[model samples]
Target: MAFYLVELTKSVTVHPRYFHAKLGDHVIGRLLALTEGTTSGRYGYLIAVVQVERPLPPGRILPGTGHAVFPLRYKALVYRPFLGEVLDGVIASLTRHGVFVAVGPLSVFVSARNVPSDMEFDETEQCFTSVVQGSEDRLEVGTLVRLRIVGMRRDATEIAAVGTLRADYLGVLG
Candidate 1:
């Protein structure tokens, strides 16, 4: 549906007496878990899943006696709404109007009529000019593009929205 709060900073002991938690952190009580892909960034880095809500106190850290309070479970992995969803993005930047696909960690918007119809828009070197010009290749600016999620809009603050790869296998992925 719609949920996002992600925040663990970094510190997860993992199964040391039911996953004893510590290290400048917290994990509020009761059920908390989320995990479902993407978090490495070749393009978008989107991976999320959290679970922390108890279990502490075991051997270790007793010299001065301090460390272990647990109560920090924020949880965030939001994106679950693209109106159609067919993500596979790259092309981090390109502008004269559009081309910004990063699909999953959020950055989707392939305007300029969703590029790829032989791509042409050189109002005299404004941008998007490559119907095979100069022969070095085309789709410049970190190209790796591919998109498909015709439309998606959200208001009431702004989670960000706007996507269109034109259609079929989307475009520019070579």
Candidate 2:
């Protein structure tokens, strides 16, 4: 899988289909910057250095535009998809379900099942709280955590993820 940092050249109106697209979603063409038009229509222009995910589409010649670049179906390429991978993430939002860890551009679901049982629910705080859950101090909302990926699935529509604080290195951080 290749990684490309693309700039929005022309303001392309993203269809509803594009909004919910996952992190690994793909795009094609030599992504370009908008010299004139806005990315507000069904289609616009861009200069992208895309890693062709499929055989190059049939090329055509457009007026003014040098080449009629074929629209290539971009395939989402996940660079890292596995357990034990260390990710820099933050506590996005929490619920009875689990804590949502925002790992860079992706969100990781750290389930309650993965949290050490030693951590107890604080009725006052409404969040799972623990004084010493096998870490330096505690586990609570807004606490910086150093977690190890314990489970993950990339094929699913939403990433199935779970983390752990059961190891020497995996736990709450100061």
Q: Per-residue lDDT of 1-174 in model 1, one digit per residue for the tens? A: 233545543333332244333422323322232234443222122344454433433324323434333333445454455467666667677776887766545667677877766677666555575676664334556667666766755444334557776677766666
Using all chains and alpha carbons, the TM-scores for the candidates as numbered come to 0.32, 0.52
Model 2 per-residue lDDT tens digits across residues 1-174: 123233322222222333333312322322222222222111222223344344534434456645343444432222333567766566776777678776654567777777667676566766777666464454555767767787765542344567765666665665
Error of model 1, residue 94, in angstroms: 1.1
True-vs-predicted CA distance for residue 65, candidate 2, Å: 14
Task: Give per-residue lDDT, candidate 1, residue 79.
Answer: 43
Q: What is the C-alpha RMSD of each candidate to the true structure, in Å?
A: 11.9, 11.2
Task: Find the candidate with the highest lDDT and give its number.
Answer: 1
Span of ten consecutive residues with least summed lDDT in model 1: 26-35
Q: After superposition, how far is residue 77 of candidate 1 from its true place, in Å?
A: 4.8
User: Model 2 Cα RMSD, Å?
Assistant: 11.2
